[model samples]
Target chain A: DAGITQSPRHKVTETGTPVTLRCHQTENHRYMYWYRQDPGHGLRLIHYSYGVKDTDKGEVSDGYSVSRSKTEDFLLTLESATSSQTSVYFCAVLRGAYGYTFGSGTRLTVV
Target chain B: TQLLEQSPQFLSIQEGENLTVYCNSSSVFSSLQWYRQEPGEGPVLLVTVVTGGEVKKLKRLTFQFGDARKDSSLHITAAQPGDTGLYLCAGDGNAGNMLTFGGGTRLMVKP
Candidate 1:
């Protein structure tokens, strides 16, 4: 919460549109993650970055893409957002043995 | 498939009540972490328990890692209205590389 920040707290877009969410951190942590929370599904990892320009897909990486061109920023992009993609997205930074610190989250709705 | 399963999806209790929420998984983890999330915000880390049969206390929250390393529990003593939030348990399934989360337990502590 102290170092991580997510932009555009809330957004509403039409189906088939492209959307991007940004997560910025001041802690300079190497591991940054993107997760989506849905009812009955809890939170599922979409993607994560271990370092600048180093990324990997998570359990639910179907229609999502991510980029971490710098250590302080990680971006999650949905090429073609669907109604089912409407949910809360959270950004997290792993702080080694201390666990993770999460951003405030971005709420997205697709109609 | 959901790797972690949380029981008692929802819990409502009066102030000063005690409650326990559980997280179970068939797969063993290197570590387990607990988080509390409030409305419109992402989850914040509460505690991280490594090692089997480990127990950690944070104020009124007591977290226990199962002896088998396949489960964990959170017991809240004298839960107050301030404790009303979604409690989530996550496992580091990849030996601290990635986390697999459980369906959260939503607690409502009415005053």
Candidate 2:
């Protein structure tokens, strides 16, 4: 639970549509990460932010983007959704004092 | 390329059975983490082992980091249906504070 919440627990849309998924945390952590979980591929990092205005691409950052303008919120955008982009997305924050805290998750289905 | 490798891409065991999931790698890490993720949910942090050869136990689940700091293993005793999930291992050893995750092992404990 870790004070983290992800918007739109589930979504289904057609291809080429614009979509945005948000992750908000009550805990002002320094680091936030976005990951996608899939069969066989496990979890692949999409984008992560170390601080406000500081973000970097991860192992699988091609079709997605993210922004962190404030300390407690992070937003992930799919500029043009595609079928391959269908997966479960998760946001996480590094608690510093303990293990990583994860959001519930957003299951997006692009058809 | 991927640094971490996990064995037994999928596993199924009856309740009360014992099982082990492993993560192996050639690159050494400062610490490694184990997580369990259920469908439509984010991966929950199960354990974190900092020092090499460290072993931590929580109830029936035991996690062990290799002495070389390049591998880890998770053992579940008397497995229960509640333990069924996708188990993942992540290695942390970079300044980015990012983790390299394994392909993951999906476990199904039948009651």
Provide the TM-score for each candidate, comma-separated. Answer: 0.96, 0.95
Per-residue alpha-carbon lDDT of candidate 1 for residues B1-111, written as tens digits (9 for 90 to 100): 339999889999999999999999998898899999999988988999998999999999999999999999999999999999999999997643888999999999999
lDDT of 2 by residue, A9-95 (tens): 999989999899999998689999999988777778899999998999999999898999998898999999999999999899998
In terms of lDDT, the poorest run of 10 residues in model 1 chain A is A1-10
Residue A19, candidate 1: Cα error in Å is: 1.0
Question: Which residue pairs collide, candidate 2?
Answer: none
Task: Quote fnat for model 1.
Answer: 0.94
lDDT for position A56 in model 2 = 97
Classify candidate 1 by CAPRI docking class. Answer: high
iRMS value of model 2?
1.0
| Candidate with the greatest DockQ versus the true structure | 1
Which candidate number maximizes TM-score?
A: 1
Per-residue lDDT tens digits for candidate 1, residues A1-111, read 458889989999999999999999998899999999999999999999999999998889999999999899999999999999999999999988788889999999999
Q: State the C-alpha lDDT per candidate.
A: 0.92, 0.90
